[model samples]
Target: MENYPKSINASSLNDWYNSEKEDPVLIDVREHSELEIACFPKEFLHIPISKVTSTYVEELFAGLFEREIVVACHAGIRSYNFCQWSLDNNIVSEIWNLEEGIDGWSRYIDPSIPRY
Candidate 1:
């Protein structure tokens, strides 16, 4: 199985998501209110960072072990921590972090996504 990269830039991430292949799952860890300021693709899984727990993990994500996963947040910090935690806990073998988060996506890929 191919290992996920530690991080991926907004441009590369855009391309990856748009490709015809089986794309990675984009998990937005930002809180619900953050969506009012900026948003990502509709396909992204909405799992707020604050609510991530063992029960949540087992219930929602256990089936995704073999799938490519990418976590994102406002500025990448929370997602980075989550990715590390996932790895440590054996939740998933590998997960990619959005290097600059949705903020980077606004600056690099889509300017329409308002930055807050």
Candidate 2:
């Protein structure tokens, strides 16, 4: 099994997207304004960090039901914190955070995506 707190880089994430027959849930934890300025692949679900608390995260995650989840933020600090929280709360799910956020992705993988 892969590491529980595994962190994936942009290429790794793209490769996972390419190889997985059924895509996992891609979650962006950025704010709405940030999303308006830039967004990830259309397949992802956007859940702002303001709504990621234990009280409301379940609502955000409703219907996902044990599926693998990839959480991202500006530079992954938020996502990493969220992953740690999920583990602590025993909300067992395969969770990964993009290691460098969209900035790293744009720098190393796809320049077409803007950096904010």
lDDT against the true structure, per candidate, is 0.86, 0.77
Scored against the true structure, residue 77 in model 2 reaches a CA lDDT of: 92
Q: In order, how many clashes per candidate? A: 0, 0
Residue 105, model 2: lDDT of 71
TM-score of 2: 0.85
Model 2: residue 104 alpha-carbon error in angstroms? 2.0
Give a tens-digit lDDT track for model 2, residues 7-106.
9998888887789466778888889998877677547888788877786777767777767788888888988877777767656555788898877777
Give candidate 1's TM-score: 0.90
Tens digits of per-residue lDDT for model 1, 1-116: 43444999999988887889789888999999998789995488888989999678757787787788989999999999888877776788778999999999999999988999
Off by over 4 Å in 1: 1-5
Which one is best on TM-score? Answer: 1
Clashing pairs in 1: none
